[model samples]
Target: MPPSHTPVQYTTRIHDYPLHYTEAGSGEILLLIHGSLCDYRYWRWQIPALSQHYRVVAPSLRGFWPAALRSADDSFSIAQHIRDMSAFARRLGEGRPVHVLGHSRGAQIALELACGAPQEVRSLILADPGFRIAGEAPGAPLHTTVAKLLERGEVEPALAEFVDAVNGAGTWRQMVSWFKTMVTDNAYTLLSQIREINLDVDLDRARRLQCPVLLVGGAHSPARYGSRLDRLEQAVGQARRITIPAASHGMNLANPKAFNQGVLNFLAGLRADEARPPAGIP
Candidate 1:
């Protein structure tokens, strides 16, 4: 049976910052990293099912909801997040490697951690990874308009613009109340996110990853995301790609059953491979 919807919440200091997270179930650690304008609560559909098989820990990144910035001076950057998450995984695993999964911007962080600190990550799962590749033509800035709307205190419009830009037109209006609330809570994070620049992941960095990688994309997602996954699959020797039917960038939430099953199947395959003896020995 799946665990309760409300997981146990906890807080721990990483890099002297209070990192908030939710914990559920037991066994191998599966760290979940949420994307832009989301917090730990973003995994509402994932925790219950995923926790049944493995320990699930989903953290709200600094500057996001439930981990609010202490002051305007508080820093927010992808590098800082990568550093904090690397430490967070180590602390959670206690010298053991843990499986890492991330969505959108968080996926970029997961990829960075797996490449930068391969010893800390047992495996990696990236869902619609949100980042520009080194050679890709620079896309028009989507954040500037949203940030401007936010600065003018047009919160809903800002959220709408950003949400629609990522998922599709009218997504913000169609979103459920809880999802809207979650995004609204961290809306200010976009201001900080826009300030950070030149953090694109390099293809060479993808090639450096030693852990097995699962690249997941939504069947109806933007072509750019699919292109990124394609490049990544070619770069990462052990990478495998999967698509969730009839879903977009928010595939996990849109089709949790398929997403959950696909993730479980990938992890199960890993466990089975690990259980097998060397080809020459057995």
Candidate 2:
């Protein structure tokens, strides 16, 4: 049987956006945010694992399913996403600093939170973030990207491709619903909106981060746009990068073992440091 999952529930409106959240486990807080074309469930693996040592809160971003915001801007712009995510963190974190892990586009959001609220963020883990290429801009609309996602093939094949990646991870059955998200709000429409927008990471702003940051990625992934670990490290003064050789963009599913272990190891270092801070800092 799968391990029992106990979810702590909470709902709060962040700037008129009804933020639907799921809290599980207990201890220091770790906020998990998802990238575009997905919701909070993307971190299903992290919560149960990290929950053993920390309180985990994963929330659906502003316009995702369940608590869809009004027909507001649907483009998954980094700044807008950052704003929404930051508001949710502040309202939920209750003024206490917390660690954060964001995957793909969510990684950019995590960086924005750290950049905007450094003191409120203790540490950050950006996994395969699209930090923009040498000659790219940020904040594109979603419709364009959705178009691209579908243009590659019909929805069925796109989903089949994704399902194929997570086949052995035990979540293949769930892919049916997971795949439905593509057509949500007109899949291509949303993708086109998101793609047209300048959806890139802001490294110039990242230079201000004062906390420990880790950039994780895999050896195999479409891996276009930005999202380079080395660039992430350079952007943030106190940052490092880790690459999972046998993994792909779908690290959580394609390579759960290494993905989980890599995350645990990084968090463990933070745990040790938190336990023993620099002299006179307490």
Best candidate (score: lDDT): 1
CA lDDT, every prediction?
A: 0.89, 0.66
Residue 86, model 1: Cα distance from true site in angstroms? 0.6
Q: Write the per-residue lDDT of candidate 1 for residues 130-194, one digit (tens) a residue.
A: 98888887766888888788888898999999898888888888899889998988888888888
Residue-wise C-alpha lDDT for candidate 2, range 46-103, written one tens digit per residue? 6777777778888877667564432335454566677887777776678988889888
TM-score of 1: 0.96
TM-score per candidate: 0.96, 0.77
Clashes of each: 0, 31
Error of 2 at 139 (Å): 13
